[model samples]
Target: MTATPTPSRPVWRTALLGSVAFVALLWVLEVVDQTTGSALDAEVFANGITPRDTDGLVGILLAPLLHGGFGHLAGNTVPLLVLGFLLLLSGVPRALAVTAVVWLTAGAGVWLVGAPGVHLGASVLVFGWLAFLLVRGVFARNLGQVALGLVLLVVYGGVLWGVLPGDPGVSWEGHLFGALGGIGAAAVLARPR
Candidate 1:
């Protein structure tokens, strides 16, 4: 008798698993940073984005993966899981493309005009994914997506103000540019193809 092949996981399940794994990685990195008495923080910031500083260019790649502390990481955890899973639900490749756009935009913007400090956190991606989810539907002209966007707007809209400069320590530049990247991604990816 021929063996029956197992069915592949549903897209939602796959997206969920991927989101969880990514969050787990962030947690692990945070643990390492904490255990080392924030030595990793120093190292990461040493190389982290310093506006207009050429030596800090590498931080554009490293910033999203580094957080100030558990408090900082925790603030981003839920948003990352929710937004990331939603983004990935479309497909890993598409999600990756969106993420890449947001990552580069946020990082480059911060590197160009951010305050004079070492900035690092996943909040940039959080803001990016939030914007992408909120606007992609409008661009795609999909009612279902529009409805979903409405729901997310109700739930996450308050955070949108983060794009503005507020706290002295906050990286609002990252948040603002990340949202821009999300909008740009939605414009490009949601086009009829």
Candidate 2:
């Protein structure tokens, strides 16, 4: 008997498109420089987003894709790639959908509980991805994966402290909400069948 060939991925094009679009969007935002403050200021969720109101909806999410500099965007690009790849491996459309829900959920929660100011950066994106990955490891009973997640958590986890407000020039609020977004994404994405 001949073995059946698996089907090609349907949404690979969309992921490619998203990656390109994300890079382009970063370039455009950098040139626009509408944060009305230092490049660093763009790190804030509200001010970083420009026009600043978020219209009370997509703002939760739209903020992460809007980065301040090449460095800031580069920071997020890898996670997007890594996490996006993982999401696609598990299931792309569902992964994207889960990410969207998590992003919005985390963003909104951050806005509500975070400090009263603008936030704009992919920090939340990073955290969300991390949470999702960590959760997956936990659920899969994969020792190596769990170890990797723990290492990531330990090395970068200190960054979480930056989310606190006491630190100067740090968007602790962004960090806080970003974490919430991540945990929320993990929960939703990992929900049982």
Among these predictions, the greatest TM-score belongs to 1
Tens-digit lDDT track for model 1 on 30-106?
99999988877676556467788997798998889989889999999999999999999999999999999999999
Clashing residue pairs, candidate 1? none
Local distance difference test values of all predictions, in order: 0.91, 0.61
What's the true lDDT of residue 59 in model 2? 55
Instruction: Tell me how candidate 2 scores on lDDT.
Output: 0.61
lDDT at 28, model 1: 96
Worst 10 residues of 2 by lDDT: 43-52
Model 1 clash count equals 0
Give TM per candidate.
0.95, 0.66
